[model samples]
Target chain A: MARTFEFHGGVYPPERKQRSQGPVRHAMLPGRVVLHLDQHAGRPAFATVAVGDSVKVGTPIARCDGMISAALHASISGQVTQVDRHTITIDSDGLDAWQRLTPLEWRTASAEERLTRLEHSGVVGLGGAGFPTHIKARVSERQRIDTLVVNAAECEPYITVDDLTLRQYTSDVLEGAQLIASLCGAKQIVVGIEDNKPEAISALRQAMAESQPLSVTVSVIATRYPSGGERQLIKTLLDRDVPDKGLPADIGVLCQNPGTLLAALRSVRDGEPLVERLVTLTGEAIADPGNRWVRIGTPMAALLDEAGLNRAALHQLIEGGPMMGTPLADLEGVVTKTTNCLIAATRKELPPAPPESPCIRCGACEEACPANLLPQQLHWYARAKDDAKLAHYRLFDCIECNACSYVCPSHIPLVADYRHAKTRLRHQQLETAKAEHAKHRFEWRQARLDREEAEKQARRQARLARQSTQQTDSQGASPQADLRSLRIAQTAAKAAVRKAEKNLARAAQQDPQQSHDDLETQLATAKENLQAAEARLAEARSAGEPQETP
Target chain B: MSDAFSIISLLSAVAVLTALGVGFGALLGAVSERFKGDESSLVEQIDTLLPQTQCGQCGYPGCRPYAEAINQGDAINKCPPGGDATITALADLLGRTPEPLDGEAPSEDLVAFIREDECIGCTKCIQACPVDAIIGAAKQMHTVIEDECTGCDLCLEPCPVDCIDMLPRSTPLAQWQPVTYPHQMIASDRRASMEMPHGTHL
Candidate 1:
């Protein structure tokens, strides 16, 4: 029985799914693989292996340095030929020359040892972002999580790699999920599968019954555009609205991808690091499009060719699902750990969108938005270049699910508009930050200039006093000159006192309760100013001139 | 005699006041309409949001005229700079927000950087700039008016030399959301396994 959901705005988009669903097939590995450093969203994994070093399949090539990054391994046994700014290429050691063995049996090691091995295996969240699985396990353990959610939603249209994986490797996926649950010390596990795939759900249930943990539950969720979205899936299955900007872990829950769990099980039980993944190759233009087990760092062109697709038929080769995928400008770019699906389509299969017409004030997009955002209003604010207004309408809340664009009768690429507007807003915000930093730099420069000017004046006053004292000694016999020197000293002291008082005044404005030490410093400065001013006044009086005024 | 005198006086006072006030108020509103212009006010505001670049990026003759058409309930987001933001503003003005201008246009902070080495001096980018930001003779390398450059990136398409590259503006630290959103972490973690047997929970 297929599970369906309510309140979802999805079109029965023509599923052109005929190309590659026959049987699981493997692609020929390339002689040289270009592994991009920043394959995932987080911190790019730093390359641990150097050029000229020989690495075997499952050899740790890059190590995770931060909480966000993932570790990388050599997909094939090869010599590292080139590591440059954009990519790292490994020329395969011809025909598996290095040792390639099956994953070790885990029963040989204790649970703690097994866990340690899993951590050292360099396994990350293979489902997509490549977050370190070990880190997540640690989080789950800390949170005292009671349940682990396994996502087999696979909601993105035309992408059935996960569904195919479950069909073939349901037991493996379950085992991976169980291993993760054990590591996290979770009590219950729930695998949420979308209702569209009844066979996968039945296969999962059958695997669970023969399995020991009679407690694992499988729930069929309604199919929706974003039902596959982690937050939405969690909400639908658990009835928990993960607080905006908060993680599932915050709510004592953790969700893992179906593929990631399988990888984790293999890593923990089999002692293997992730080296390859199942990539979905589906699109109307392709001669053959289906799920194929592909090695990481496989060139897209090569993968398409392996899938029996002719490049001439494919007008565009896109990375990921048709709805939210990015168009690959260069097929030379190799697949990374995050490459889940590669869709190859001809223009005729998915025709170019019609020319955009003026909005007739129709509210179709808002009605279609799953996030409950006023997409129409957002578009308006976005069009006006008003970032503030866009923010006010909660533009950041838009998940870019493409449902809005899918429903627009006018054929507007609504999601693209939101993305572009969002990108611009982010860029402007960055500019604002740079401007603020520049402002601070200018202020600091000005303050430094003021300090230097003050210091120069202080030095000049000291030098003048020294010269006057020498003059007084030289003119010791003249009473008038002696009186003049005494008066100059008094005036200088008074002037110093006045300057100190001004400093005190400014300080008082900044802080009401001046410390005794601060007050004393101010007094001292004031005394110096008073003395200097008095000295000049006295000198003027002794010289028979009018006394210097205060 | 006393009762007849009171009634007559009251009736006489009411009749005089009602006649004078009614005649005066009616005369004032008639004078105001004669001075008021018949031009529509809403059309002027919509014209401002149009890029005014007059680059024909919108497939319109000019921006102000496009605004006039939009004021009459045309699609928003025609201007690339205005992009989604403009659509939103127009939506605000017209009291409707719809996905209208979700089409493709270069809407980033991009200014044409002349590749000094590859300049054939075709002066094509200058002709393409709707804002007249590019200044150069037909045979000389052109310079972009940095302040005037809206970064619409219209010049990039027309460059025969392909010298113009729309460099992605650097995201300052403040605006850089941690590239890894939490949901991706959760999603990736849930389905990380590729080889698990069907229906089995880890």
Candidate 2:
């Protein structure tokens, strides 16, 4: 038995995963599937198929738009019913056909080839984050990764999809882990499983013994809620703290969920895109509580109904687990790449939170925080909308595990406040960046205008100087020359006025109904110029210079 | 003979004190010249906090001019496009109390739209635009680059045919952010119940 390490504060939530334990069952095909383009964390994928097009299972419906995004494939043979900005709806034809990529020999394939396969297969972190796996694996290019931590903790209560995945396909999971380790040049693999899942641990251990290619070790950690978190698991397995606002790769360690590893394996070895995943359907309101292999884009209501959901007894329908799951207000919501578990909990089973009260200033919340954050202070600052104070307190480090909210004596939703504050802070940062960009553009435009103005002024000065030199050469230094030039300028201004008046008249006659405002303004400016020219000529004449009409 | 010696000693002491005063004054002048703070950089710092709309609602020609005026003890609440946020930022930077906005705050961000068919091709709006967001030639239909438009509304008055319309900016679906936490459930549920074409429940 390998010695394990301890993380910071954590709580022991009841492990209600026993009810969901069984052989994984294949869910019925959904009549219609709604696939969101932005199922992954980064930029949304671009739709490749159009409406009225037919698609077989595993057919590419959307292609990755950027390096951080993942491709999307059809989960069932279907006709594209609608293609919109956010999602693509496909109506199944009940064929359950296939269109798959070419499988690759993971051991013999080059690292680049295996990575490309992973990128094209739409594999993401199935532990609920939905981060594109290829991007995470590509971190090896910048940093030398030494350890690959296989997270099998499944620490959240009522979530047994990972456990069931390990029990059913233990060797496949290990093989996926080894493939990723080789891809990242990692020398050792560490499987971190909480002691609560004895079956999963035994299966993992037996699979490791059967085919031991790389150095593998199983670290059975104590059962604790949220121990499955990436940061927490890494701390327990390797005792390495992922730095503030940094990734696991920064410390030469990469943590991957077991389900995500299996998906990667299926994509490379079986040439199958990530179309289906095992989802845990449990809670007291469910008649048949067990894990089922659900297709992506299946409607939540249909899956719950198939699991014998008692609507009358169901108080709330959570999309993940009790500790971190989001409450589903609408049953029509469809599953995506991140959907892992659906808990149709009864009112008594998961009671509604009591009304919030003023904080008693007790240290219970601080003690329960897994990230060692001061929830009480954070709650106050978040409510006050004090961004500076929240930043100073390292608000971004919060994993939003709801541990503080669970232990709050005042029943305050600390995690909710923190989430709101984080969103606001992020929005503020984006706005500041935009403001800075606009300033730069404005300044650049100003500088260009100034330079153009200076050039024009310089050109006008040179023209004036050249004209004066020509005048000095043509006419001897005499007052009559100045008078003659003034008279010439007056005549030219008079001609300009005549031309402006004639053009304005023509424009008015050409379009009787059109407003001739621009033409009128031009004529008015020309008249003003003629008046100034006449004034200058009169002044020259009064100066006693001979006025010669040219 | 003793009185004559005292007068000579007093004159020598006065000469030494004058030399010391001049020497210390020269050193102090050199130090001040070498370590003088850059005043324009202060103006630059203030300008960064402004929204850079260049709308001239602050009685200045542009954001930089307003930043200069603020550096010279001008009020920090005249920017309507920046609104109270800019005022608060300026106040924080200058260590002064934030004042209420001097002018009516813009209700929402707006971008100018040219009714292409109605445009007379005067190019007045193009010239009036401070950010050069509008692109066109003389006697050619002008259009606003929505992304670069600051929504300053400076071109509205210069448009001779009244073809320019200031409309609320529309956010693309890709840029739309989902509300988090407590309100997320209700907002997403409402969106689903309405059966909006885009059925993303993130």
Candidate 3:
């Protein structure tokens, strides 16, 4: 496919990729593995095995809660040792032998049976999308899927595990792609590789020719950072722009990373859950830099040591690619399901910063931005802390791709400004929610008071009527008798008024009122309500609970 | 006889005008170039606004390098920092229409504040900062120059500080731009939160 649109805002840094581009080798199992619960974007996995339980390699240690989370398995045979809020650390001690844990003998299951076994296994998309593979398989079964795009575009620099996977285990990667296509019932399969990895592509092509039909095709992508981004890759290969918030499925396309495909093949055929992953540990400062097929939950520091990168001279330990990666502080943090690369660099490989100066309105950032955004304008509004203007400009849609910052001549951290503004806006939203909640409570309280006042008025009217009837019967012609009863009723009403006054006073003390006028008005209404209620009660006594007063 | 006379008159007039025009053009070109000084300084100033990750997301090799291209009559809105804020600033500087900064950077309102506690003394942030604003060591705490910080936030991502939080700058009545100082002060700190680029300058 030809290059489509003018992608502005790009940087061409020194390609230090050869550091980890060699053959992918497997690292020996470590003594301990710390599996983080939240290895994916959605909900965390639930541990099926308790802390004291024994686990074997590919053992189902935990299960997925629902569609959002994936199940966890033991990468190595071990004993459940520790469980924290978000991670579980297992100690590897026994069972060095590769033995299948499934007593049901899942390997012998048919293709349909394999799909069933996978659902029970709780396998998810290990391609970093973390979508449950069973769901994808099931969805594919319903529709006539045209193609299965196997994303080998490990476009993020210093990440060549997929390349190594293709070179060393070419058969595995291809077989997995075929199985996924057959399972999903797709008509065609395309394994997208960035042009830089020609050897891997050739190896994959050779492997596909032996067993499967020519349905499996190898396509090369331009070597650009984030070329492996699902949407970007889809756009690059298919010339289709998946809507900003749309999925590939919406456009009748399905994409999966090479690593994720291999995992799916292993899970369906072997009845294995996602337990191990290929991690690329390389950087400039690293002493031994290459790709390592490590068990999930291995501490980054341990892998660093294996890669010969010590924590001493290291300047930064970033998870994933330099372009769109999270900077991790402690090297001791465990690798999760999505971690593809751990980049540790020195000052030389990644140079030290220059002093920041004022912006001179140079347009280089705009020209480099791939998304075609005006990075300069974003910087201006962000610097001024004008969040509203930022929102109006669709700040939320920014991919945080770092294109603007990379192209800026002023060394302005444009992305950082955008992030800060978003976070602050989120904080503002929470504050607003809290205030509205309080207002709702006040409105509820006011409604209750109104209802109680109306009830009291009805009772007061009934009581007065009853008193009049009782006076007529007791003192046929005696005005003096009626006078005495009226005085008694008046005294009772006065006491009721006092009680109402006391209740109002108590409420006032509990919550101080700044508007005395408002309080006075409320107090006056309460008193009037109490007076009417007392009159009704007096009448009710005289007439013995008078008939409903209209 | 008439044709010959007309041709000679026209030739003489054209020759005189051509000489004067060439002389004026040459003089103006010489004056402009002499006063322009070096364009590099302007590029250097623009480079400071970039984060300097050299990720090429902006289509340039690095931040400073992009600035040079900008001084050469490139579009001013490319740098995300000079986004809307940068555009307005550029308009103020060069007199142009202020366009909104592009939305290429997702959720662009983030700021980088070093989490002092989590800092591991790695000077990655300092090195990665296109502008050497972060000050710390291979294993010491780093501090940001608040006054000097362009608020471009490039330093945050490289911070081993998990600490470098991109806190959005809060706007108050005082912070509004096209900034008017020592003049009329808007009452109510309920300032408009806009998506502008870095720089406290109006």
Candidate 4:
């Protein structure tokens, strides 16, 4: 028995995992599948196929967008029906045809080749995070990893997918772990699981004995809720705390989910992409409560119907365990890589939460928190929307395990508040970054405008100086004097024309019949004189000689 | 003999006091010179707090000018684009009381959109944009770089053909956030009422 360490705070909820204890079964193929572009944690994959394109199972439908993203493959042999911004829907033709890459010998293959194969396989962390697995494995380039931790704790009650995977494919899981260990150059591998899963523990132990060359050990700890969390499991197994806002890699450790390891093995050995995963369907409202190999993009309604769902008794449908699962409002929503367990809970089995009351400062939540966070304080800060205080309390360290909420005497939704606060903090950080970018661009634009203005002013000053110097050298009168005389002549002509027009207007108003013709003649003569003076000025200017005011 | 002794003591006291005053004054002047703060950096800090929308809604030419004005005792609540958030941040940095926004706040985040076919190859918007987010040359069709655009709306009036539209920024589906508790409850309630009939088919 490998010794284990204890973490801060944990709660032992009713381990209602007996319902889904049977062997895993393959589910029937659906008539249609809707694959969302963004099933992983990073950038969404860009679609490589159009609406009318024909595709087989394992066909590369979408390519990875960036380093942190995962590629997506078609789960069913079908024709693409709709290609929208969010999802790509395919209608199956009822054939299980496949398009696969040639499998590589991982032992003989270089690390880069194995990584490329993993990238092409679209394997992600099936432990509900859906983080791309290849990026996680590539940590060996920058850091020297010493241990690989296989997370098979399966601590969340009523979710038996990992347990069943370990029981059925123990060697495959162990071999996959070895493959990752070799890739990351880790000398030791540890499988951290709960003692309640005796079957899985025994299977892992038997496999460990058979794999003599690989250094692998099974560490079975007491079953506790949220012990499956990456940080908690690492803490329990190695007594090492992942630094705040740091990753397992920072501590020279790499933690990979069992399902993700199995998927990577299949991708490198069988030339298969991640087309399906083991899903646990169990609740009071389910007639056949067990695990099944459900294809990605299978609709919730179809999967539930296959499990013999009790529609009238089903009050709420959750996508994960009852502790930290999200309730499903749309039955038509399809399952993605992160959908691990489905719980069609009845009203009595999982009743709606009561309305929240003010906190009594009982400190039960603090005692039950697995991450050692002060849930009551976080709740107050979240309610007040005090982002600074929430950050000061280290709100980002919260894993949203719902242990605190479960043990709260007042029935406070502590995890929900923490999730909201975390999202708001992330949003605030993004806004600040954007503001900084905008400030940079604004400053650059201002500097450019100032430079342009300075250049224009310099050019104008140079032209004035050059003109003055040219006039002094070539002519007796400077251009400044010439310009002054021209301005005086033009003003005098404009005043004479105005006087003539006013006189004509006055004569017309007094006695229009007698004096209108005489004033009109005077006005015409003044206009002619003005035109003659402007023509002389223009001729002199065009001749490049100074013009005298008339 | 008593008068001579008293005069000598008074003169000695005056000389000692003058020496102490001169020495302390020299020390104070050196310390003040060495520790003098940069005045422009204060403006830079204030400018960082203000949103760089450059919308001219704050009655200044840009965010930097407004930041300078704020440092020069101008009211901090006049920015509509930065709105209350900027005011609170400025108050925190300047150690002043936060005030309510002085003008109408923008109803939503807006990005400028140009109807391309109606652009008529005019470059008016390109010149009007403060951040140079719009790309075009004279007598060439202009377009807004959506990511670079700060949504200042300074280019709206510059369009000759009235082709520019200030539309609310559209969030991509990938960026859509999950609904929090209160909103989630409301959504479930509405779903229950509407999906009851659909449930029967199952």
- Per-model TM-score versus the true fold: 0.60, 0.82, 0.57, 0.83
- Alpha carbon lDDT of residue A161, candidate 2? 90
Candidate 4 lDDT by residue in tens digits, A1-550: 8889999899888888999999999999999999999999888999999999999999999999866899999999989999987789999999989998898888889999999999999999999999998888888987899999999998888899999999999999998998899999899999999999999999998989876356899999989988999999999999999999888998999999899999999999899999999999999999998999988999999999999999999998888887777778767778899999998988877776654456899998888787888889999999789988898888988887888878776666677777777777777776776777676566556545654554454455445546865766535243332545755776787788799899878877754324354355456556655655555455335333432332
Candidate 1 is scored at a TM of 0.60
Worst 10-residue stretch by lDDT in candidate 4 chain B? B193-202
Residue-wise lDDT of candidate 2 within A1-550, one digit each (tens)?
A: 7888888888877788889998899999999999999999888999999999999989999999866789999998989999998899999999999998998989999999999999999999998889999988887887899999998999888899989999999999999999999988888999999998899889888888865579889999999978998899999889899999888888999989989999999999999999999899998999998998899999999998999999999877888888888888768799889999998888788876655568899989889888988889998999899988998888999998888887777777778788778877877776776666556556556645654554454455445545765675424232433777878988997898899899989988765545665566556556666666666565445433322422
Root-mean-square deviation of each candidate, in angstroms? Answer: 16.9, 12.9, 23.6, 17.3
- Candidate 3 lDDT score at position B127: 64
Deviation (Å) of A531 in candidate 3: 32
User: Which scores greater on TM-score, model 2 or model 4?
Assistant: 4
The reply for model 4, stretches above 4 Å from the true place, is A450-550, B1-18, B97-101, B174-202
Chain A TM-score of each candidate structure, as shown:
0.76, 0.84, 0.73, 0.84
Candidate 1 chain A, run of 10 with poorest lDDT:
A541-550
The segments of candidate 3 whose C-alpha lies over 4 angstroms from its true place after superposition are A1-9, A97-132, A135-145, A182-185, A210-214, A426-550, B1-202
CA error at residue B83 for candidate 2, angstroms = 2.6
Q: Write candidate 1's Cα lDDT for A105-183 as tens digits.
A: 6545556765555566656665566677777877753467777988888777677877888889999888777777877
> DockQ for the candidate 2 complex?
0.16
Candidates ranked by lDDT: 2, 4, 1, 3
Whole-model lDDT values for every prediction: 0.67, 0.84, 0.65, 0.83
Candidate 4 per-residue lDDT over residues B96-161, each given as its tens digit: 999999989898989999888788877888888987789977777888888778899999887778
Kindly provide the TM-score obtained by chain B of candidate 1 when compared with the true chain B: 0.57
Q: Comparing chain B with the reference, what is the TM-score for each candidate?
A: 0.57, 0.75, 0.50, 0.78
| Model 1: per-residue Cα lDDT at residue B117 | 71
